[model samples]
Target chain A: MLRHAIALLSGGLFGSGLFISGMTDTAKVQGWLDVFGDWDPTLAFVMGGAMIPMALAWWMRSKRVTALTGEPLPPAPSKEIDTKLIVGSVLFGIGWGLAGLCPGPSIAALSYGGPGLYVFVAAMVTGMAIAPFVRARLDRAVPAE
Target chain B: MPIDWIWGLIGGLLIGTGGAVYLLGNGKIMGASGIIGGLVDGSGLNTKWERILFLLGVAVMPVVLYPLYRDVDTHITDNYWVLIAAGLLVGIGTRIANGCTSGHGVCGMSRLSVRGIVATCCYILAGGLGVILFRHILGVI
Candidate 1:
């Protein structure tokens, strides 16, 4: 119960942060990305500011074996840089540039209705659904290390 | 009105704190893509309820603040083709990469993960190229 509550609060905070920071606004996101055009630097500050607490959290993780909820800390992600990471990020970036919505903002912007919103999300989900198969093919060709 | 950097900073603090809470209390990385993506891909079945609850919180916050944020607009393109194409790329890209802005940008960078940093660079560069191609060159989106 406590774990669930904490998850809820964390997610709520994240969602609220996205909303308050104007991340839910696709224009703002596109504006930030539009450096050659009229760029908005607000997202830089958001990214910078967001790193503060998270950096501290990592420090805390280094010192503690267990979490506040008494759960063991999850393992850190692998350090290997691979083709999938680069290609996938590039693909994702193109989408983000085109639509100005990443995973978090896309989900957070759910209530902020627009016809394009649902369509974008549905297509995103479909892409996700098909990713495993695509990945399998890619792996067969060039085996991810 | 254009958003101020001050609000971005403030909201960023909240976002960071939220990540901290999830990390320190829940003992997990709060990658939005991975959280929801895993559920869709069937890898997160063991933690289904937790994922759902977290998503509920994410989805509900706007409604809770709807009174204050009544005029919020995403300004996304009305073109269905653009929307679908963009969405598909985002979905496939993030999944194949194994992270997104939240996972790689926020969580991974904070910890100085090499993969996170590399992925971030790749995406930002590609995004810039994409903007140039789609918006400036082709004038599609």
Candidate 2:
């Protein structure tokens, strides 16, 4: 019960922050990505500000195995920097540059009520649904994760 | 800096605090893509309710706050083709990478994970390149 409650609160906070910070603003996100065009550095400040508290959280995490609530912490992240990581990141970046809306903002902004929003989200979800099959094929070809 | 920067910072702090709460309470990374992606892929049925509730919270909170932030507009392109293409790429890429801005950029990097750092660098550079190519050269986006 506590865990579920925490998730709700955290998720709500995350969504609220995205709106308050203007991250859901596609124009601002695109402007930040537009380095050659008139660049907006606001995202940098946002990213930096977000990292500060997260960094502290990580420090707290390092000192404990389980969460303060006694649940096991998430498994440690993998260290591999393989082809999949590079390829995926690049693809994601391209899409992000093009659209300026990521998974969080995409979902969070749904209330804005636009046909294009649904179209983009539907397409994104479709891509996710097909990814496993694509990965399977790629793995068969590469044979080495 | 514009007033937007201040709001960005304030909002960022709230986001970080949200992440912190999740980590300390649920003991999981608050990754938007991974949470929803796991559900769609059927790999996260064990935590189906958790994911749903989290997503619900994420989806509903903005609506609750909408009246207060009525000026918050996305300004996304109306081009259906572009939206489709970009959406597809984002979905596939984040899943394949196993993270997105939240997972890799915020949580993972804070933990000093090498994979997270590398992925962040790759995506940022690629995003910049993409902007140049699509917006400047091709004038598509």
Best candidate (score: lDDT): 1
| Residues B79-135, model 1: lDDT tens digits | 899989999999999999999998899999999999999999998888888888888
Candidate 2: tens digits of C-alpha lDDT, residues A40-110: 98788777877888889888887889996798988778888877788888889999999998898888888
Overall lDDT per candidate, in order of appearance: 0.88, 0.87
Please provide, for model 1 over A12-57, each residue's C-alpha lDDT reduced to its tens digit, 9 standing for 90 to 100. 9999898888888888788888888889888898899899999999
lDDT of 2 by residue, B23-134 (tens): 9888899888899899989998899888888888888888998887747768889999999999999999999888899989989888889999999998899889988999
Q: Which TM-score value belongs to model 1?
A: 0.96
lDDT of 2 at A31: 92
Model 2 regions lying over 4 Å from their true place: none
Please state what fraction of the native interface contacts candidate 1 reproduces. 0.84
DockQ of every candidate structure: 0.83, 0.81
